[model samples]
Target: MTLYGLKTCDTCRKALKSLDKVEFRDIRSDGIPPDVLKSAYAALGDELVNRRSTTWRGLSHDARAADPLTLLAEHPTLMKRPLITDGTRFFLGWGKDVQADLMR
Candidate 1:
């Protein structure tokens, strides 16, 4: 399984700590290669971009409206944190609810 997010991200850290059973791969440090990021997009759709994030807030309205692929290609930070994937299922963001499911 792969976990795509910054190690410093609170949600990512919490998810990791909460679910000790799973091994995770931090995409921020490993630097998700372009191909992988593209595949993730394909899997998760544009929802991968966290519209509520500070990074998203910094982008212009035009940028937000632009294609997510273009935005992600240019600014990978636009992606939501804790992008967890278990080869088939893709999850964006982290929360207690997800933790419960993941832990189970």
Candidate 2:
């Protein structure tokens, strides 16, 4: 499994600590692959974008208004935490539903 997230994010840290056999990618350093981002956007839709993030809060209205996919590509940290995938299925966030799916 590959986990895409920020290394400094507490939630990401928590998720990383709990998972086994996972490859962690720090989006700040290594950007998400466009195909994976596209697939994640397809699977999670608007939920894939994190509007509550500090990066999101700092974005100008104009930037925020851009297409979500475009915005995400430009600012990878704007994506929600720990987007986990196995090159097929995607799981966003470390929520109960996602944990349930991945832990199984």
Candidate 3:
């Protein structure tokens, strides 16, 4: 199982702490390698970018209107943190519901 997220993310930390065999990969520290980013977009399409994030919201209207690929290439933080993925399964955020799904 592999987890893609930032170490500073509390939810990511919590999820990691709950697991004993996770192959943790800090996307922020390691940086979202182009291949992984490409796969993320391939797996979820444009939805990979989360407009609800504060990072996205902080963008100006013009910036917010930018294309997803452009946004992802320029500002990946807008794509939600703690994007935990267990190869086949992918979780967008940290919460009991998501945790339950991932833990399964």
How far out, in Å, is residue 58 in model 2?
1.4
Q: What are the models' TM-scores?
A: 0.74, 0.94, 0.73
lDDT of 1 at 17: 77
Can you write out model 2's per-residue Cα lDDT over 1-104, one digit (the tens) per residue? 99999889898898899899999999999998999999999998999999998899999999999999999999999998889998899988899988888887
lDDT of 3 by residue, 4-99 (tens): 777777877887899768887776456566767777777777667877887887899999888776787678677776676666656776778877
Looking at model 2, report the run of 10 residues with the lowest lDDT sum. 95-104
Q: Which candidate's lDDT is highest? A: 2
> 11-65 in candidate 1: lDDT tens per residue?
7888777665566766555656677777788987868877887878998888889
- Name the regions of candidate 1 deviating beyond 4 angstroms: 21-24
Question: Using TM-score as the measure, what is the rank order of every candidate, best first?
Answer: 2, 1, 3
Over all chains combined, what TM-score does candidate 2 have?
0.94
How much is the lDDT of residue 66 in candidate 2? 99
lDDT of 1: 0.74
Task: Give lDDT for model 3.
Answer: 0.74
Candidate 2: residue 2 lDDT (0-100): 95
